[model samples]
Target: MKKWLQFLVLITSITSTSALLASGGIGEGSEGRSSQMPPVMNAKWKAECSGCHMLYHPGLLPERSWKAVMAGLDKHFGESAGLDAATRDEITSFLVLNSADKSANRRSSRINQSIPTNSTPLRVSETRYFISKHDEISASTFKRKSVGSSANCIACHRGAEKGDFSESQVRIPR
Candidate 1:
C-alpha cells in the first residue's frame, strides 16, 4: 500500500509539471515569454483604417471593445470613419475574431486580463496593461515632435504594424 501511494504521488507530480510546461508554464508576469502579438490581417481593415492612421492590431482590444468601436464608426475618435454596411460588417467580424480576448498570444492574453470585466476600452492606450508598461514614460515624451503621441506606437516601436512590441525592439524617439 505504501509503495502504491508513493507511485501515485510521483506520477501526479510529473503529470502536473508536464501540464504546466505544455501550457507555456508560469511565465514572466502575465505577459508570458513573448510580447509579440499574433500576425492577423484583414485587407479591408488594413486599407480603410490605415489610410487615416497607423494600423492597429486587433489583439490590442477585447471583443466587446471592438464591438463598441465598430458600432460607433461615425464618431470614431471624433472622426467620421463611417463605412458601407458590407465593409463595416466584414471589418467588425475580423476585429472581433482576432481581438485580445480571442487571440492565443500571451501578450494579448495579458492585455485582456488587465481590463476590468465591466470596462470596454476603445483604445489600447486606455488599458491597464498599456498604462503599466508605459508608466515610466512621461507625457512630455509622448508630446515630443519625434514621438507624436502614445497612440503612435510605430514611432517608438518600429515593428508596431507587424504586431511586434518586443522590449528589445522598442526605440522611443527623441
Candidate 2:
C-alpha cells in the first residue's frame, strides 16, 4: 500500500509538471505560448476594417458593443466608414458571433469580466481590463511618436493582428 501511494504521488507530480510546461507556465493566460494565435481571420472583416486602421479582433469587445459600432459606421470614430447593406451585415454577424462574451480564450474572458453590466464600450482601450493591463504604462509613453496612442496596440504588441499579446513578447519603443 505504501509503495502504491508513492507511485501515485510520482505520477501526479509528473502530470502536473508536464501540464505547466505545455501551457507555458501557470497563469500565463491563453497567449502564454509564443506560438498561440488568435482565431481564424474573416477576410471581409480584415479588408474593410484594416483599410482605415488596425484590424481589431472581434474577441476584444462584447456583442452589444460590436452591434453599436456596426450600427454607427457612417460616423465611425469621426470618419465615414459606411458599407453596403450586405457587407455590413456580414461583418456585424462575424463580430457578434466571435465577441468576447462568446470566446473561451482567457484574455477575452477577462475583458468580458471587466465590463460593467450597464455599459457598452465600443473601444477595447476603454475597458477596465485594458486599463488594468496597461496601468504600468505612462500617458507620455503612449503619446510618443513610435506609439502614437493607446489605440495603436501594434506599437508594442507586434502580434496584435494575430491576437497574441503575451507580456513576455511586449517591446515598448523609445
Candidate 3:
C-alpha cells in the first residue's frame, strides 16, 4: 500500500509540471527546442482561410483573439469573409484549440505572454512580440513592392506558411 501511494505522488508531480510548462511562459527556457511552432492541420481551416490571404498558423494568437476574429469575420480586416454557420464554428474550434496560449512552443509562448489580458488584437502585427522583432525594419521596407506589407511574412520568411520562421532562413527581397 505504501509503494502504491509513492507511485501516485510521483505521477501527480510529473503531470503538474507538464501542465505548467505547456501553459506557456517567458521563463519556459525552451533552449531552442520549442522555437518552431508545430504544424497543425485542419482541412476546413486551410481551405477557408487561405482562399484570400496567407494561411496564418493558429498558434500565432491566443484563444480570445481568435474568438474575436471569428466573431467579426463579416468585417475581417476591411473585407467580408463570412461563412456558413457550421463552417465558421468548425474553423473557430480549430483556431481556438491550437492558439498560442494553448501551445508549448517557446516562440508561441513568448508571443502569448507579450499580449495584455485585456486586449484582443485581431492582427498579429499589433502584438508587442511582432513589433519588437520587426522594429529594425522600416515602414518603407515593408511597403516595398517586393515585401507588400509586414503582414506578408512570406516576403522575408520563406517558410512562414510552414511554421519555420528561423532567423537563418529570413531573406528580405529588394
Candidate 4:
C-alpha cells in the first residue's frame, strides 16, 4: 500500500509538470517567450487614425473586419474618411497584423460572427460587445471631460494602448 501511494504521488507530480509545460508555462516554456513584445501604439497608426477618430486599438477588430473597414473608408460611419491608397495600405496592414484573430479569446476571434455580413454599419460601435460594454454610460456622458468620443478608450481604460484594461487602472475624469 505504501509503495503504491508513493508511485501515484510521483506520477501525479510529473503529469502536472508536463501539463504546465505543454500549456505554455510562463518562464518555463518557449511558447510565451518573445524577442520583444511590440508596443500597443506607434507613430504611424496614431498619425492616421487619430486625425478624425481617437487612436483606437487595432487589436479590437478581427483581421477580416479591419480589412473590410479600410476598404470602405469613404462610407466609414457615414462619413468621407477615405485614406490615400498608400496610407490605406499601411494602415490596413498594421491593423491586420494586430487584429483579434490572433487574440487568445475564441469569442474575439469571431468578432463579426454574430452580425450579418451584409450589415451596412461597419463601425466598431455596431458590434454587440461594444454595446454591452458601453451601455452604462448616459447619452450626455460623452460631453464629460473624461470621454472625448466612443473611440477614446484610453480615457476609461488606462494603458489600453498596451493591451492593459484592468479595472484598477480606470480613472474617470470629473
Candidate 5:
C-alpha cells in the first residue's frame, strides 16, 4: 500500500475509535442529554440559553464581559434583545463563577486562550478548525439541503455533543 493510503487508514481508525468512546457507545449509558445539565446561572441567563449552534457555557466569558454583553443586548449585534432585570443578575453571577478561569473543560477555555481578539463572532463555526474543514466544499454543495452554510453544526457532524465529527458519523446529504 502507498504511504499516504496507510496514513489515511491509521487516522481513520483512531478517529472512529475516539468517536465511539466520546459518545459513550461502549459500556456507557445513554447518548442524548447528560444526567444533569450544567447549572444555569441566573434565571435570566437560563431563559436566554440556546441549545443549538454555539451552545457555549456562559463561563466562557469573564463576569465583566458577560455584564457588558447582557447590558448591550438591546442593540446586540444590530438586533433587539433583552432580559428582565432579575434574570440578568442570575446570568451575570453564573458567568462570573463558571468563566474560563473556573472551567475544567478544554473546549470552554480554548476560546479565551486562543481567540485573542474580541471583535469576532461567538459561534464555534467561525473558528479555524471549522473554516478549514469546510473550505473545500463547493458553493453548490453548500446550497444543497444536506449542507447549509459552514455554520450548521449538525450538517457534517453527527454526534457533536460527544465532540465527535468523524467520517463514520458524517451523513452528507445526497
Candidate 6:
C-alpha cells in the first residue's frame, strides 16, 4: 500500500509539473510553440467569422487592426457582415485581448514585427510576414479552383482552422 501511494504521488507530481510548463508560467504571456497551435479561441468569433469565411485566429492581427475590422463589419471586405451590437462587442473584446501584438507566441511575435508601427492591416495576407512566407507561390496557383484565393488558408493548410500552419502539413491543392 505504501509503495502504491508513493508511485501515485510521483505520477501526480510529474503531471503537475508538465502542465505548469505547458501553461508558460503563472501570469506569464501566452507564447506560441512551433509544435502547438494558437491558444486563443472564442466561440462567438468562430461562429460569426466562420459564417462568412475561415475563422481567423485572433493572434493573426494586431489589436488596432482587429479594432478597425470590427468597427467596419458593415463594410467587411465589400460585404455586410454586421453583427448585433452585443455580439460585435464580445467578439471584438476577444480579438483584441488575443491579438498578435498582445501574444508572446513565436508566430504572433513575428507577425507583429513584420508590420510597420503606423500600419494596421485588416488582412493577414497583407502582412509582411505572410507575404514573405508566400512569396514563392505564383498568382495562378492561388487562383486555382481548389485554392480559391490567398485568403483561403485552409485550401493549402489543412490545419489552418486549428492555427497549425507548419510547412510540413501544407499541401496546396492542385
Q: Which lDDT value does model 4 have at 48? A: 79
Write candidate 4's Cα lDDT for 33-121 as tens digits. 23112356556678878787656666567777888889888998788887789888988888878776565443344354544556533
Q: Candidates ranked by lDDT, best first? A: 3, 1, 2, 6, 4, 5
Of candidates 6 and 1, the better by TM-score: 1
lDDT of 6 by residue, 56-137 (tens): 8887889999999999999999999999999999999998888888876777888899999999999999999999999999
Find the candidate with the highest TM-score and give its number.
3
Question: TM-scores for all candidates?
Answer: 0.80, 0.80, 0.81, 0.61, 0.50, 0.79
Q: Global lDDT of each model?
A: 0.87, 0.86, 0.88, 0.66, 0.56, 0.85
Tens-place lDDT per residue, model 3, 50-164, is 9988889998999999999999999998999999999999999999999999988877898999999999988999999999989999999999999888888988989888776
Q: Which stretches of candidate 3 lie over 4 Å from their true place?
A: 1-33
Q: Count the clashes in each prediction.
A: 0, 0, 0, 0, 5, 1
Candidate 5 stretches with Cα past 4 Å from truth are: 1-43, 51-55, 59-65, 117-174
Instruction: Give the Å error, residue 78, model 3.
Output: 0.9
Clashing pairs in 6: 32-105
- The best-first sequence of candidates by TM-score reads 3, 2, 1, 6, 4, 5
**Clashes in model 2: which pairs?**
none
- The sequence of per-residue lDDT tens digits that candidate 5 reaches over residues 1-174 is 699999999999999999987764544224433321144435444447543243345544444456666678677657776667877667667766776445544444554554445544344445554456567778787678766665565666665433444445677676
Model 6, residue 36: displacement in angstroms?
A: 4.9
* 3 or 6, greater by TM-score: 3
Top-lDDT candidate index = 3
RMSD of each: 7.9, 5.6, 11.0, 7.3, 8.2, 9.1
